[model samples]
Target chain A: MDLLLQLTINGLSMGSIYLLLGISWGLIFAVTRTFHFAHGATFVVAAYSAYFFQQLGFSLILAAVGSVLAAVLFGMAVEGILYRYLRKAFASHLVVFVAAIGTLITVENLIAMGFGTDVKTLEGFPIKVIKIGKVGFNNLHVVMFATAGILFFLLMLYLHRTKTGKALRAVISNPEMAEVIGIDTRKYFLLAFALGSLLVAPAAFLVTIERGATIDLGHWAILYAFMPVIIGGIGSLPGAALAGLIIGLAESIGIWKISSQWQVGIAFVVLVAVMILKPTGLFGFRVYRGKI
Target chain B: MILEVKNLVGGYQNKRVLHGLSFSMGDGEVVGTIGHNGAGKTTLLKSLFGLLPPWEGQILFRSHDITGRKPDSNVKEGIAYMPQGQGLFPDLTVMENLEISCFGLDRKTLKKRSQQVFELFPILEERKRQRAGTLSGGEQRMMSVGLTLMHEPTLMFLDEPSLGLAPRIVQLVMENIIEINRRFKNSILLVEQNFEQVKRVAGKIIVIKLGQIVFSGILDPALDKRELWKYF
Candidate 1:
């Protein structure tokens, strides 16, 4: 029916944003094994940075590029300054987890201090709607889909075809063995964090442009991002994207059939179902470390 | 001397495995370290290659102290380590495994080295696209040895190359090691439990027992296997 078509279009558009968030989280998690809860903070930082630059008389595209670059630098800084020292000190997983949570709180507070605690809006995004048979498409949605599609293609190419990308995969596969093979796993870790942060940049800007910015946006970003990754495999980028789309579709349909209040809960319902059925997500495999 | 480990002491947290172990190897020398399961042979190799840094004494490579350098730095300095259990990225393909071994090399060199690997082990060529995890046990061993050669290291540490392979495959692996040593002129430190394999490939033999070198000398065919068994 017409309703189904409309829901599907909305789902796909939402899927594009969720896919970026999932991939960004998955990248850093897969490489560094840091459950990077602070990604939520970085998401806010990037959006706010974009908003700041745009307000500074820069073009939207230039602002977006600058924001993404800033996010990457922030990601690297987090790893180098916080996580690296903890790892060197042989900190336990719980300690590292607590540290990550601490980082999230610190960054979130900083954002509120710099940008106001109140929700802020981003203007100037031209909203031109196009009508299909029974569904409508906005220019922003189309742009979101196109950007997601193009970036996904490029990411796949980078992961499978490039040397540094393969090095990242190697580190993810067996970090200790990767070291024995002369791979500087640290460099690959930085690359993963940077790439992951970079992937989220456009999504941050687009979301701000579409829905406006809020202090709570980063917190919601983590939830939206992590659910897809958990539903997919933790380290599988393709699965994360696929799961993102599935969650988005489910949310759209659920909102239409049920109530709008349950829209966010739909993704979690799917996540719980997936956790019970397939614990490793869709594409997770055991990473082989050498036996002693 | 290419490598000299002087009174080196190292182990896991609180459990010292190498208790003042000392040994030295010259260029192009294939030193065989043979020991029982708990004799710390693997630990010794791990310490030398920087997997576990020595707690005491010095590790001199080309007269420079590389006592506790990181494993990646050691590899870059011409030392390659292939640990037991065929330390490989099992999910990656044979080509991927070879490529990752010499990461950061130019595409042309990567391709050329891959070709050379195929030539060294033609079976690897046939399974270039196959996931390394799914390969047969013998094939996995071959791929492990082949990977270390990708970087063209001047010094190599092979931990238990013949640990879990058929007699036929063991022969093939030993042959490959001998050929690699001759061709690359690499100083090799081979740790293995199989005394027969050790005697076959190593000109100098060192026996480790309870984290210490009990014996060090040239391979003597006249020496009874029972005599070495007693030490282990």
Candidate 2:
């Protein structure tokens, strides 16, 4: 029972990271209707940017801010420069998706060429463990959980309270109606990219601190990012977050009886089960036309 | 003239829907367009509002050559379009929907405009906090019209405001459209299928057939309604 408790605690911390990744990808997909596979590249860029900034003797917090800004610029560039051109060319969804995959591969290759395919770690965060009853977790775990909770709260607040956020919701609900009301759908698409990139920065930074960063982290990051979205539902943000937690918990608990190497496979099993049982995802409604 | 279209030609990607359609409207006049399902009535509104770009045409709004401009630019030029269905966002609250309609307005202006909408449709005010999707069909229609009123537009392109409502609700919606024109003196280009309702509000009527205007004239009250069937 104590061991189960420990795994559950660990799963929650890991789930927070997945939650960040899922919502970042989900928001972009929901608003722009673009399958941005290159979001993985955005994750790697943010992690590397933080590492690069810290090597320049910047404070940890400043390095994080710099990373977020870099991620935002890179994400916006993907939408503003690449995606905008494709859209103007009237590219189909499949074509845009293929372009995104090509971009991910090209960027990953460039990073590998520049930094080599080795693990890189970000330092400065103190490693300390805290014990709660029979369960134990590190300071980083607490930070991850708190950060995800706070950010989620802030995101919901922004969506409900701010004008720009409401405009994004409008686009998500009905792009045609949104345009008819004079909302600049293009501007909102760029904004979705920006915010999506910003949300992933903390996840990248946290993971780099916990397990170090690698050139190939992007591929796995994107896979995990998409797993939650697909398991949750296509257009539901809360659904993605919940699915992230479920996947994290399932993977963590599965390691009790099986090898830890099979942890990744556990997520796939959950995804398949969800797909088979509920094709629209756990929280997905049948007529998911305009609810976010 | 408040608006004029000269030899407008447009459609969706190779399937030409509007073929050399030309018309003009005066300030503060309500013009109704009627047609069969594929007669390009909605296409006309889309082309004029820039949802569908005109392939070859000159759109003159208050004597300005605004051709192929996007919807945002058209909205800034005081043109508002209410799409065919429930134009309001279903997930958003009534107040949120209204807030998004006049997106760039100041808080004071937003408050004033919202107050005006509430006055026009008092039920909207009562249901301001309710989710727009949960509203009855009639209430949703009212909210759709209320959204167009948010920016106090000089020109409105309303596509089928009475599309899926009961008979009594259709009467109420037509009456509201008349009220909107009378109160704002706004030039309205209304596209509707129900000719009986159109006769209640429109001073002029244009009949479209397969993307071309078959008849354009005044809606003479003394004329037999059955005679209009020839154009359809």
Candidate 3:
């Protein structure tokens, strides 16, 4: 029972990371209707940017801030430059998706060539284990959960309270009507990209500190990101967060009965089960006709 | 003239819908545009409002040449377009729909405008917390018009305001359109398939067939529905 409790705590902490990734990707997809597969590249860029900044003698806090800034710029540039150009060129959804895939491949390859394929860890974090009864967790786990909770609260507040945030919601709900109402859908699309990128930075930073950064992490990050979104429903942010937690918990618990090597497979099994049973996702109201 | 479209030509890619269409409207006028399904009634509003770029010709709005300007710019310049169907965000609450329509307005103005909307459609206020998608068809139509009211637009392009509603709801919507024109002094270009409803509210009637204006004149109360059938 104690072991189960420990695993649950670990799962929740990991789930928090997945929740951040899922909502980050979900926000961009819901708002822009863009299959932004290159979001994986943005994750790698953020992690590498933090590591690069720290190597240049910046404090850990400054490095994280710098990483977020880099992620925002890179994400916006992907939308403003690549996606915009493809849209102007009259690319179909499939074509744009292919372009995004190509971008992800190119970026991952470039990073691999630049930083080498080997793992590189971020230095100077004094991680300590904390115990609650028989269950134990690191301080980093607490930080991860706190960060995700705070950010999610702030995001919900922004979406509900601010003019720009409402505009983004308007675009997500109905792009054509949003345009008619003068909400500037293009500007909101860029904003979605920026915010989406910003959301992923902490996940990238946390993961780099926990398990070190690697070029291969991009594809894994994106896979986890997409699984939660698809499992939760295409356009529901809260759904994605919940699905992320479910997947994290499922994977963690499954390891007790099977080899830990099958951890990733456990998430896939849950995804398949949800797809077969629900199809629209756990929280999806209907087949996505542009509702956030 | 508040709006003048001179030889406007535009349509979807590789297909022409509005072929050299020309018309003009005075301030605070309610002009009803009647036509068949493919008669380019919606296209005319779309082109003038900048949803679709004009292939040729000019659109002068309040004497300013706004030809080919996007919808956002046209909206900023006091044009409001309520497209066919609900023309609202279904997932958003009725209040949210109203809030987003006049996005950048200050709190005072927003409250004032929202009150004005409530005055126009009091049912909207009662259902403010309800999601717009779940509203009855008539209520959804009312909320659509209410959204346009939030910005206090000088000109409104309302496509098919009475579409797909019961006879009683249709009458109510037509009456609301009349009230909107009367109270707000907004010049309206109303598109409708049902000429009976248009005749009740419109001062002038513009008939289009296959994208060309067949008739543009006063809505004579004595005009026969049979006579209008020939144009269609």
Candidate 4:
């Protein structure tokens, strides 16, 4: 019984990571039809960026600053150069999808060539387990959960409260109408990509110390992200968070029933079953553009 | 002149919709643009707003040669277009739609406009928190027009505001138009299909057929539905 409780706590902590990742991906995807296959590379790159800054004897705050600036601009550049030109091609949205995939491949290869395939963890940031009765969680988990909570709260406020946020919502709703109404949809797209990069920063930072950073880290996290996003409903932020928790708890508990090697497969089976029955998932209001 | 389109030509990729279409609007004047279903009424407004590019010709606004500029630039220059076909941000609530239209304005101004929108549309005020996608046809039309009102532009371009609205609601909408004109004294270009609604508030009326001005004069009832159908 104590084991069950311990695993639940462990699950919630891991859920925090995926929750952040899912909401970020869903938010970006909901706004810009650009698949941003380069999204995952941005994650690992941020991890590496922070590590590099740490090696330079910077404080945690400075390291965060380094990763954020690098990630934000990289996101902006991706939207500005690659996606902006693609929008003018006057082709179907599928063209952009393919181009985004190409971008993903190029970024991943570049990272592999530079950083090599090996994962690299930062030197100073180390996890120490904080035991609570029968359940034990690292200080990293508490910090990550707190950070994720703050991010989610801020994101909600931004999307629902502010003016530019309303504009973003409008652009996401109807690109043509937003254009006619004098919204620079291109600018909105750029902002959305930047937001994606910003959201990935914490997730990358969260895992970099314990798990290390690698070119494939982004893809690794995305595998977990997909389940939460699907179950939560693609564009629903709150739904994604809830699903992330559910997935985390399910994966942790499934370890009791099946081999740890089959955890990923078991999650997929659950997701496929839910998708077949409830295609809209928990939040049924997600609006997606073009043929997915 | 507040607006002038001279020798303007524009259209889709292969098909030309507006050919040398020329017109002018004056400050404090209500100009009604009437046309058939495909007479390019919406296209004319779009071209002026720079949604559709003019292949050749000059578009002058207030003695400024405002040609070939983007819509955002034109919007900043005091042009708020209430697009035809009820172009609205569905999935957004009424309040959200208003907030987006009030872009970059301070919170105080937004608050004033929200109250003003309520004054213009009491139902909207009542349902300000409601999603626009769920609005009834009449209400959605109201929301679309209210969106344009947020910018408080000097020149208002209202396209097919009467589209799909019932006669009673249409009459109410017409009263709102007159109310707007009287209050702001802003120049208005009204694109309308219903001649009665057009004639109710329009100071001058111009009719378009097949991308050309078929009639340009004061709107007299002698030119009624039967005559209007000829253009259609």
Highest TM-score: give the candidate number.
3
Residues A1-292, candidate 3, lDDT per residue (tens digit)?
9989888888889999999999999999999888899999999999999999999999999999999999999999999999999877778999999989888899989988888989988988889998889888999999999998888888888988888887888888888999989887888999999999999999999999999999878889899998999999988888998898888899888888999999999999999999999998988877555455
Itemize residue pairs with steric clashes in candidate 4.
Answer: none
The CA lDDT at B114 in model 1 is: 84
Candidate 2 displacement at residue A252 in angstroms: 0.7
Real interface contacts reproduced by model 2, as a fraction: 0.81
Where does the lowest 10-residue lDDT sum fall in candidate 4 chain A?
A: A283-292
Stronger candidate by lDDT (3 vs 4): 3
Residue B78 in candidate 3, Cα distance off native in Å: 1.5
List the lowest-lDDT window of 10 residues for candidate 1 chain A.
A283-292
Q: Candidates' interface RMSDs, in order?
A: 3.6, 1.0, 1.3, 3.1
For model 3, what is the error of residue A199's alpha carbon versus the real structure, in angstroms, after optimal superposition? 0.3
TM-scores, chain A, per candidate: 0.96, 0.97, 0.98, 0.92
Q: List-wise, what DockQ does each model earn? A: 0.57, 0.79, 0.74, 0.47
List the candidate 2 regions with Cα displacement exceeding 4 Å.
A286-290
What's the distance in Å from true for residue B129, model 1?
2.1
> Mind giving the per-residue lDDT tens digits that candidate 4 earns over B1-232?
8988898888876789987888888888999998878888888888888887788899999989878889888877888888876578878878878877777778899999878888988999888888788898889988887888787888888888988888898998889999989987899999998888888899889888888887787777566768766655
lDDT of 2 by residue, B1-232 (tens): 9999999999988799988988999999999999999999988999899898899989999999888889988888899999999798988899999999989889899999999999999999999999998999999999999998888899999999999899999999999999999999999999999888888999999999999999998988665668988987
- Candidate 2's DockQ: 0.79
lDDT of candidate 2 at residue B82, scale 0 to 100 = 92
Candidate 1's C-alpha runs over 4 A off are A287-292
Off by over 4 Å in 4: A57-61, A174-182, A223-227, A289-292, B13-15, B85-96, B229-232
Ranking by lDDT: 2, 3, 1, 4
